[model samples]
Target chain A: MKFKNNTVTLDATDLKILEALQKDARQTYTAIGKSLGMAHSTVYDRIKRMERQGIIKKYTTVIDAEKAGAKIITAIMTVFTDPKESENVAKKLCLAPQILEVYTSLSEELLIIAKVIAENQEGLHEFIACSVAPLPGVLRIRTSMITKKFKETQFSIADNSKVNIYKRNP
Target chain B: MNEKMASRILRTLSREKAFYFFTSIGNYTGESAASLRTFVDKIREMNLKSLEFHFYRGDFEKWIAEVLEDKELAEQIGTFRNSSPIGESLKNELYRILVRRYSKLKSMLY
Candidate 1:
């Protein structure tokens, strides 16, 4: 039904639709409707409502950077900056094309975790030297090269407990 | 196959303890999918220790460049990049390569 903190009310059918779309975003509305035993129009309406409510964010394609001729590198940097400068540093890091994911750790020190990509070892060195090392308030940078990957996936609607409306209804 | 060949194949498989199979749901029913499933099954039957298999989510070019470490093959696969559900063609190419490698390994053991 309704989320505790928000006004968005979603039912069983909505959850099913969300799961189906998560599995394959390219599926036609008609195809999704057929599987869910609902009309295509109903499927479209629900998706639109969810989008408006911000439950459904932007649809995107996830690329395997390592397979795309880029080496995956992760770095944990501890920034020694004034509290006001932290937000500015984050914004600057987000603007770099090589940076993929960025997050601030909860540790006492201002720890920033970032995932970056480069074509090779030399390219990686260049990125750290030119982009990351030069960023203001970046005190120390520790980097690890990802040699192999085991499992990577996008957010799964099937795994979300909030989307288990079918269980509650049934 | 001779015992020597069989032993060599076993040795190679033993040394290569892990495999990463990059694929997408787009080619779920293709021959490549079948081949990969079979390859995994074979590996499971061997009951080797420290072996791992990763089914990565992506197209063939990505797999070729990342897993196979073949720049030339990645370029060739890139030609089909614009194709919708690029996984189908990628699976086909990957199947061809895996089939050859697997067959050689199979012949030695059998």
Candidate 2:
């Protein structure tokens, strides 16, 4: 019942709507409403409100990377950099197209972590040596290669109708 | 896979056998594809509204399965249809799978 300011609080109906969308975002509003025995207009309004509140972000689909010819080696890299140059190193990592994600972490060590993907081992090596190692204040780099991914999922909209969420408090 | 099998999968079809894009039972979008390559392009540039209509109607799967006779592609589009998407995302996903299949079949020709 309680809510944080500007946060979108989802009711049971909202949760069910999110669940239906998670299954298939293109589910006709009428179909979803019919399944829930709610009016399609109501469903539409809820979805619109959710959109305005930013609870339901953009709709999307996941690609099978390998199937789509994006077969590559993914490495979670830990780069140690001088504290003064840490911010600069992270910025540089973000500009590299091969680096999908970059983060600055103080966990265990002051480090910059990046998710890097390369078409092959040679490309990966080239990136680390030419791109990463050449940066100023660069320290040692350790990479853990991802072998096989079992599962990847987006946000879980599940059995939590009873879970309390704060509504947008204007 | 033998060359003959690849040829069969990649062969061009006659006008009667080409896959046509339709918004409804009678209304055609004036776009038809005789090969996987053309099919991939048609899917890429076709009208989104018409594409969405045909998508939910299972027209794409039926044509791919029965006419193109490619069980793999038909099944791929079928599974995608079952887990449906709409709008631009739908177009992008459909194009992605179509291109992937087209590329694989193309590589087999060599």
TM-score of chain A of each: 0.79, 0.80
DockQ of each: 0.01, 0.01
True contacts kept of 1: 0.00
Regions of candidate 1 where Cα sits further than 4 Å from its true position = A1-9, A64-82, A162-170, B1-110
Q: How well does model 2 score by local distance difference test?
A: 0.77
Model 1: lDDT equals 0.55
lDDT of 1 at A159: 76
Please give the RMSD of candidate 1 to the true structure.
21.9
Per-residue error for A95 in candidate 1, Å, reads 0.3
Worst 10 residues of 2 chain B by lDDT: B21-30
For candidate 2, write residues B5-107 as lDDT tens digits.
6678777887556665645332334467787778888988998987997788777787777767778887898889877699999999999998898788778
Q: Residues A70-113, candidate 1, lDDT per residue (tens digit)?
A: 54554333334445556777788899887888787656777667
**Compared with the true structure, what per-residue lDDT tens digits does model 1 show for residues B1-110?**
46564444334221122232211111011111122335435334421211111222233344335444444545544543435322344445444555555566567565
Q: Tell me the native contact fraction for each prediction.
A: 0.00, 0.00
